[model samples]
Target: MGADEKAQNKAEKLGGKVQEGLGKATGDREMEAEGQKDQSKANLKDAGENIKDAFKK
Candidate 1:
């Protein structure tokens, strides 16, 4: 929920997007799947932070 966590989550999401793009370009299905999973995990963490922040208000 803190700034560091948010930054890390954002970085991870960006990395996942890059990975997915690279995988698709190279025709690597496994890599694409992994990237999607990473993106999902990052999104879930972001959602959790948002929920905590909302409760704090």
Candidate 2:
């Protein structure tokens, strides 16, 4: 994966973590779940990009 994609994925994961933390502090189950979902999506995208790169090599 390119640098931009990697950075974006990292940022997304970080944002999700922050969101989850805030949700937990506020006792919002829905927000916490959404944050977890966001993190998972970002991780999946990163994994997919890595797979593509491997095939290219």
What's the TM-score of every candidate structure? 0.92, 0.97
Off by over 4 Å in 2: none
In candidate 2, how many Å is residue 10 off?
A: 0.4
- Give per-residue CA lDDT, model 2, range 1-57, as digits (tens): 999999999999999998999899999999998889899999999999999999999
Provide the lowest-lDDT 10-residue window in model 1: 29-38
The local distance difference test score of each candidate is 0.93, 0.95
List all candidate RMSDs to the true structure.
Answer: 0.8, 0.5
Tell me model 1's lDDT, rounded to 2 decimals.
0.93
